[model samples]
Target: MQLTNRSKQVSNKEMTLAEKMYLPAIVGGLAITISHFFRKKPTIQYPEVKKYLGPIYRGHHILKRDEQGRERCTACGLCAVACPAEAISMVAAERKKGEENLYREEKYAAVYEINMLRCIFCGLCEEACPKQAVYLRHDLMVPVFQERDEVIYGKDRLVENMNDRYIRVANSEVQATPTEPSLTRAAT
Candidate 1:
């Protein structure tokens, strides 16, 4: 006494010898395995062939430098706080009177370091930086490391080189110019 009209028809008929052997099911599985042999493999060979990373792909982190080649990080600790993985650490040092050309701000990061092994490359540090000093490079990726000691990147590796400046694609021309315009009083 079924109450629902959606009940499926049940087969109570005895199965044939070939049907019980499950030869059809076995043949279907074998056919699927053989068909995959002719298909293209999606594996990529590294080192010799680099993968095409998209424009927004976040890679190695960098501490940016101003147009004058002065370190822009002010040791505000905003980036360190924003890092969810707690991979970034830094020590602030007061800029000396004679080192005006080296740092953009009075306070600068003296010991900035990021553990590549712990870092998730989430780019939160870049967003949290008010000075726009911290940025994840889109063009370059962190190299393969066999030893754990090499994964920890210090200020020397994070600092942008003045001779070979890293330029963002969206602001290639803009980055080449000065960060701000000179505001002077006009002669009345």
Candidate 2:
């Protein structure tokens, strides 16, 4: 047995000669094309005129340093472990005597690398860092490389300089706060 709903059936009737000609459809399409032709273009002259990326825009990653210009990374492997893509890898080394100027902690990352091709840049590594040593910065741009090996950033590439913008911001924040004594000022 078949069930019927008494609904109105859609007509599949053949089109008339005028409808088959599609004159209205053609005219409507041409009208749209003509309207767009006179419209103002949204094209940007890139490299000459830069678009503003708002604050909190995440870009390339950088390993941060303490106010004393010492490496903040303890080599705890938290950033590597938190990475969903498994792009991060590092080797921890014990900070030797007189190396206190170089590393903030007893253990430091002797070898730290991040594979750009593998990294999703989800900012998980930045969030997972307990020491605030790793961060995805807005200013820096990660450039394209020819070689796959070139994409894998070592400490030399990943580590930011002492006068880095992020480090300056951190220093300013610490100095601005009344409760916090500026380590950079205290050291000097």
Q: Write the per-residue lDDT of candidate 2 for residues 1-188, one digit (tens) a residue.
A: 44778767799899888779999879999999999999998775544443434345567888998778899999999999999999999999999999999999999999999999999879999899999999987544577689977998999988878764463243222232112223212211
Best by lDDT: 1
How many collisions between residues are there in candidate 2? 0
Task: Compute each candidate's TM-score over C-alphas.
Answer: 0.69, 0.69
Residue 80 shift from truth in candidate 2, angstroms: 0.7
Which 10-residue span in candidate 1 carries the lowest summed lDDT?
179-188
Model 1 Cα lDDT, one tens digit per residue, 1-188: 99999999999899988789999879988999999989988665444444445456688788999999999999999988999999999999999998999999899988999999999999999999999999998767787799989999999889998887877775323221111223211111
lDDT of 2: 0.78
By summed lDDT, the worst window of 10 consecutive residues in model 2 runs over 179-188
List per-prediction Cα lDDT, in the order shown: 0.81, 0.78
Error of 1 at 77 (Å): 0.3
